[model samples]
Target: MLTLASKLKRDDGGKAGRASGASDSTHRVSIRDRLLTKEVSELEAHLPSTCKASFPDEDKLHHFRLAVSPDEGYYQSGRFQFEIDVPEAYNMVPPKVRCLTRIWHPNITENGEICLSLLREHSIDGTGWAPTRTLKVHHLH
Candidate 1:
């Protein structure tokens, strides 16, 4: 018998079992898709008539892109792109996010690792992480 974690690590029949099992993967995917769809819709509806968010591939629903044009700042005219990656444990944990576009900022490292409040590991011992908040990113400027 394979452990639950081990089963989830495999790519073939393993996925099928988990996809149909009682674990969070199945429900996670559905909830994530719905949340993402709703988020995209809301963003589309209220985005400053200039920005946009879209999924490049229909098959890979976990990945999407956002185009932002800061209203103020040195990057005002520059178009910034961000890639969002929704993990299988979504709502329970924040999505893994990184700036795909090259940027220079005190909080953003040269390698694209963002040093934000939410992204910070909670404990100095690295044994605990903060609970996921509803809205992860508010303002990047």
Candidate 2:
């Protein structure tokens, strides 16, 4: 569990930790934190019309919500939710993405696991999902 005060603590770069002479370890920020910040900032600035993101626990930067609603497709008007977890390795390792909304799709399972070529870690040719691949947050059709 997390609270707003703690969330702000890190968001503020632990200035208090420094002032209190706390060990440097407490103030260290990982690469994952920086990357997540950029991603979160970009998403907040230009989120797509059919998609939305919410941080239920700000402390858990790795987890977030992505709600999608296809405007023109078989799934049109249907609300679909996807929980995205960005691993620390990020570009080096693909995020663990799963559907939270139930739907009948060849690539998506009833249990919510998705099997998209791009989302998959490995392809038939033994190639892994490109680390440079763009993250999609809207129109999952």
Q: Give TM-scores for every candidate, taking all chains together and pairing residue i with residue i.
A: 0.61, 0.76
**Compared with the true structure, what per-residue lDDT tens digits does model 1 show for residues 1-141?**
113233234434545766676464443436665565555444455666446666677545567676788777788888877777777666666656677778997877777766665654454655333444432243222
The lDDT of model 2 is 0.71
Return model 2's CA RMSD, one decimal. 3.9
Question: Residue 69 in candidate 2 has what lDDT?
Answer: 79
Q: Which stretches of candidate 2 lie over 4 Å from their true place?
A: 1-21, 125-127, 134-141
TM-score of 1: 0.61
Cα lDDT computed for each candidate against the true fold: 0.58, 0.71
Off by over 4 Å in 1: 1-29, 120-141
Cα error of candidate 1 at position 11, Å: 24
Error of 2 at 31 (Å): 1.5
- Candidate 2, residue 3: Cα displacement in angstroms equals 14
